[model samples]
Target: MKDTNKHQGLRNQLAKQLEEKGITDKNVLEAIKRIPRHLFLDSGFEDFAYQDKAFPIAAGQTISQPFTVAFQTQLLQVKKDDKILEIGTGSGYQTAVLVALGAKVYSVERQNELFKITSALLPKMGIRPKHLSFGDGYKGLPNYAPFDSIIVTAGAPIIPKPLMAQLKIGGRLVIPLGEGEQIMTMLIRKNETQFEKHEFGEFRFVPLLEDKN
Candidate 1:
């Protein structure tokens, strides 16, 4: 119980950071507050959990910063019961955030090692999303098309076209575009034939790869 209190303290710090950074979405802030960032990170680095910096997790990938996670979730405009597709599960931290926001999450991870860790952690965290898949996230999940929101954790040179097509009309997809250094971008599917683009800010993320493991 005392440890839970410490966890809550970290969460409060995260909330304060988000609020100071102008993250006004109450739901997004709430999700950030509720998800345990420390638990998702390596035990050795648990002290840095709320420090607003990406930390290396199991795979070559790193867990995204709190602001980046909150920023993307805010841009996606998730609603309760909305179907969300997340590319690059990583530590399953963002997946846990999506679940906290009350979205039915479908997350895909390309690295076998990271996928395995996340699959085991989600249940431990009590964040049971609708589905978790191990594969190339660039393909998205065809079987569960027309998602209300989509978020890609890694940086892709180009937004995967199939992912755009998978968005429902008026749905939003938030992704990072570029190599090495990237800019966080959002795409709103205005209709079946068109999308509106918005550039949020610059961010750095691991490359979105196609490797099986």
Candidate 2:
């Protein structure tokens, strides 16, 4: 059985942080609360998993700060069992959160090491889904097109058109935009030829890169 106390404490901490930051989405807050953040990081840093800060993991990527995760996820407005395409699988933390929120997540990790580690870690955490892939996040998973939502974990110089095309009409895509420094961007497809874009705020994330693994 899972450790209820640790889970409760993490939930409380994340809830307080989200409230202080004005994250109003109850579903997002609860998703962050239920998932065990510690399980997503290196054992040495597990104690700090619930803190509102990023921590280094393999492949020179840092697990995103808790508040950022919650903020981006809140923007998605996920529904029960929605199919989600996650562009980056750093540490698999965000994927775990999506699964906890009842999403059927299909995650692609460009970093082979992270892909392997999380492939093993997620199942142990009871966050199993039918698909996990090691590939470039830019290409997306075309075979599973028309995802209910798409979340790009890394920063892109511009939104990749291919990834955008994968979204279902009325679907949401949350990605970090800009070249050097980045801003969290949300795009909702309005129709075959149109979308609505909103910029959140300045944020830091690893560059989205090409991969063939």
Candidate 3:
């Protein structure tokens, strides 16, 4: 809960490193510099929090690598108050970043453990997403459909049709597609039946699971 000057300095360095690595979005970079990443990790990993690496979190998930988060955020091209649907809430670090950039996020976490923990933790850190749900990500939150943007934080074997159907026209869906090493893919909704696809190279992520309570 304590974001010390030392932590601030580390975040500054992390932001600079991300910029050098081609993360050019100033809002995304500012979000990285402001959110206390160390707070999302276990105390033992605090020293490693700002290293541009993923570290283990609860429920057998890893907080996403910083570069991956920034890259995806940049791809979303988030605007203030944009309604975003995030497929995995993991450590809530990515959720916090989206919030920092002024998006109203509705995040779904498949793991109940992560769901409960993050639902409580985020507000404590003053990062409030619009909603947090424990459910299958493939189904998405149809009740809150037509999001301004959608981000999937896990590796998907195929793009879930429901997610595609739920996007607003001109919305962006950033997902990691594949099994072992995923291709970071972004789909921009062009019309009712068409999407513009782009891939941003490879990344490793835990599989996006389905059919769990």
TM-score of each: 0.96, 0.94, 0.99
Candidate rank order under TM-score: 3, 1, 2
Q: Please, what are the lDDT tens digits per residue for candidate 2 over residues 1-213?
A: 345696688778878888789899887888787887877777798677778899999989989998888888999998989999999988988898888888999999988898898898888878886589998888999999989999999899989999899999999999999888899999999999899999988999989997644
What local lDDT does model 2 show for residue 177? 94
What clash pairs does model 2 have?
none
Q: After superposition, how far is residue 21 of candidate 2 from its true place, in Å?
A: 0.5
lDDT of 3 by residue, 1-213 (tens): 899999999999999999999999999999999999999999999999999898999989999999999999999999999999999999999999999999999999989999999999999998989999989999999999989999999999999999999999999999999999999999999999999999999999999999844
Separate clash counts for every candidate: 0, 0, 0
lDDT of each: 0.89, 0.88, 0.96
- Per-residue lDDT over 1-213 for candidate 1, one digit per residue giving the tens place of the 0 to 100 score: 123888888889889988999899999998888887888888888778888889999877899989899889988888899999999989998999889988999999988898998899889767898999998888999999989989999999999889998999989999999998899999989987999999977899999986554
Model 3, TM vs. native? 0.99
lDDT of 1 at 132: 96
Model 1 residue 31 lDDT?
85
- As a TM-score, model 1 comes out at 0.96
Cα shift from native, residue 156, model 3 (Å): 0.3
In what order do the candidates fall by lDDT, top score first? 3, 1, 2
